[model samples]
Target: MIESKRRRRTVANIATYFVLAGLSMFCIGPMIWMLLTSLKYEADIVTQTMQYIPRRVTFDNYVAIWTQSGFPRLIGNSITVTFLTVTICVATGTLAAYAFSRFAFRGRTQLMLGYLVVRMFPAVMMIIPLYVVMRGVGLVDSRFGLALAYTSFLLPLFVWMLKGFFDSAPRELESAARIDGSTRLGAMVRIVMPLARNGLVASSVFIAIAAWNEFLFALMLTTGQGSRTWPVGLQLMVGEFQLPWGVLAAGGILSILPVVVLFAIVQRTMVQGLTAGAIKG
Candidate 1:
């Protein structure tokens, strides 16, 4: 019986590893193809036969996108919008989440549920109302306006995710800080926030990624190159008569660098926070 169980466990482990490997390949295959395509010349890419490997590698695509196209401006706009979105979401979401986690008030449950309702609505549904409001307020066609649009959708998500993390933080610590003459906000800043710092990082990264890759709102909100983001700018690269695949691929690669660097810097912290939240919340 023991021997049979051991054999079964080994087989299960092998199957799990195979499944994981296959999924990893599925997710990473497109990225690898894009990177390879970016390195190839236009002639090599637009070939008669399937060319998995590049005949020649060149940095010309990168140079052209950077120097010739408005891609740099788009990248700058994406960065600016992402910064603003993450900053606003984190600042407000943290406080709102802490309130939900600590305080009991009338309609608290209903309010939290309302946030979930906001998230449930399709993003497209909000566009008309947002456009009308933005136009009325003279915020249309601006990066800050785009950032505000992102905040409308992402703030609820940030609050919900962060409330879970805040819930995991011990109330006893805050109470102890209060006894030590710390104000409520001081207790949160000095004690609860430190404890939940990892959770905060995880939530901020999530919001930042959403803001970076968001396209529809960016496309709808901004008309000019001055405010358009990378995704929209890349889409506009496809002309009526021609498709610049190599340039687009190069742009895609360049566009991902900021996110990649962000992940590299915060990988350990984000991982710890996510794992801790999973276990604790």
Candidate 2:
């Protein structure tokens, strides 16, 4: 009976490995294809049949996209907008979340519900009104305008998510600090903030990723290279006569690099925060 049970366990392990391997292949197949296509020449890419492997690997597509297109400017704009949006969301959301989590006040539940509802509102519905307001304010074709719009859209989410994390935090830590002569604000900053570092990092990562990938607003609100983000710039690569698949793929690869790097850096903190919040809550 023990031998039979062991065999069953070994079979389950093998099945699990096979399933995981298949899922990994499915996820990575497109990325591998993109890399290979990016290295291939236009002639090879445009042929009737696709080439899984390129005869000649070259950085020419990357170079062309960088030098010929205004990719550098687009990258800069994306970075600027994402950075500002993340900073604003993190700052405002952290304070707002702490207030909601720690303090008791009238209409607090209503206010939190309001934030969640606003977050649920679709961005497409707000585009027309936002465009008009941006136009009225002379911010139609500006990075500042795009960043502000992204922050507004992202802040509600950050507030809701961070509030959950802050709610799960132990109140005793803050109370101890206060008992030791720390002011309320000082206790929050020095003690609570440090304890909630994982949540803060997770929220920041989400906001940054959102801001970086924002397309509709960036495309509509911004014009020309001055405020165009990478997503918009990448769309412009397809010309009337021909589409540059290699360049587009290279640009896509470049665009995702920062997000990949960021996740690699903060993945541990994000996982820890999310797990802690789940367990505590």
Candidate 3:
């Protein structure tokens, strides 16, 4: 019976691995194709036959997109706005999360629920109100304005995520720190935060990616090349009479590099953060 059960488990594991591999390929297939297409010449892209592999690789498409268009400006704006959004979320969300995790204040439950309520509404519903507020404050068509717009929606998510991580950290340690002459903020900074660093990184990366790829807010908030993000810029590159597949592919590849690099840097931490609560010691 033991041998039979082991054999069945082995077979199930093999099937699971195969399914995971297929799904990974399905998700990553388009990215691989895009990278190959970006490396191809314009002539090789719109071929009579489906050219899976490029006969010749060229950097002309990358050059054309970088030099001919306002893509660089768009990239710069995206970086700036994404940075600002992540900074604001981290700065504010961390404190709010800590408060919710540690305190027994009045209406705490209601306040946390309100944060969820903000996220429950479709983002589209807030566009008009946001536009009016941003315009009134002379912030429309600016990178900072766009970042603020992203924060309006992403902050609640950041707080909720970090709050879960904080909950995992023991309150005993915090109380011990307070007894040792540490203030509430000091206890959090010294005791709770280090334990939850992975969670903070994961939360920041989530909002950063959201801000980086956000198109609707970027479109509605900004007007000129100075503040427009890469998504909007890439969309604008598509002309009525012209479809520069190679250029678009190159732009797509370039746009994802930052996110890929970010994941590579924090991948281990993110994995730990995600699985932190699954197995408690």
Candidate 4:
């Protein structure tokens, strides 16, 4: 019986490893392909035969993109827009979430419900109205305008997610801080927010990634490289007359660097926060 059980356990372990290995390949394969493609010569990329591995690897594409393709300016624009959106969402959402979680007021349920409803609609539906508003305010083709546009889409989700994290903390913690003479805002900043840090980081990561990768609004709102994001610039590279595969792949790799570095830095906190909220809430 013991020998039979050992055999079964070994088989199960092997199957699990096989499944995990396949899943890992499915997820990371494209990223590997993009990186490899970026390093290949344009000739290798355009050939009739598939060149899974490049015969020649070079940084010429990377150099060309940075110096010639307006990638640097687009990178700056994307960073500015994404950072501003994340900041606005995190700042306003955390405060709004605190209010929702801590206080009971008139129309509170309705207000929360309204946030949910607004977020449920397709983002494309809001484009026309948002365009009108941006145009009216002379914010068209501006980084701030794009950031604000992104905020409208991300804010509700941020508030709802952070509110759950806020709700998980005990009221007595704040009450105890109140007894010690901290103001409400002071207590939140000092006591409650510290406990909720992981959730905030995780939410910020999601918001930043969403804003960075958004193509439609970036294309519609910003006409020039001065305000256009990497996504929009990257799309333009695949033009009507010809396709620059090597440069496009290089741009893809470059665009992913910021997000990858960010995820690597805060991923542990993000994972813990995500699972912690699920368990606590």
Clashing pairs in 1: none
- Per-residue alpha-carbon lDDT of candidate 1 for residues 1-281, written as tens digits (9 for 90 to 100): 99999999999999999999999999999999999999999999988899999988999999999999999899999999999999999889999999999999999999999998988888899889989999999888999999999999999999998999889887887899999999999999998888888888888988898999999999899999889999999999999999999999999999888888777756788566433452345
Please give each candidate's TM-score. 0.92, 0.90, 0.91, 0.91
- lDDT of model 1, residue 143: 92
Candidate 4 has which clashing residue pairs, if any? none
Worst 10-residue lDDT window for candidate 1 reads 272-281
lDDT tens per residue, model 2, 1-281: 99999999999999999999999999998988888889998888988886789988899999998998899999999999998898888878889999999999999999988977877767889899999999999988888889899987899889888888787768887888899999988998988787778878888898899899989999899987888999988997779998889999999899999999888867777666433452336
Ranking by lDDT: 3, 1, 4, 2
Candidate 3, run of 10 with poorest lDDT: 272-281
Question: Measured by TM-score, how close is model 2 to the native structure?
Answer: 0.90
Candidate 3 residue spans exceeding 4 A from truth: 1-18, 271-281
Off by over 4 Å in 2: 1-15, 271-281
Best by TM-score: 1
lDDT of 4: 0.90
Instruction: Kindly report which residue stretches of model 4 are placed more than 4 angstroms away from their true locations once superposed.
Output: 1-5, 271-281
Q: Residue by residue across 100-173, what tens digits does model 4's lDDT show?
A: 99999999999999998987877788888889999999998999999999998889889988999888777887
Leading candidate by lDDT: 3
Cα-lDDT of candidate 1: 0.91
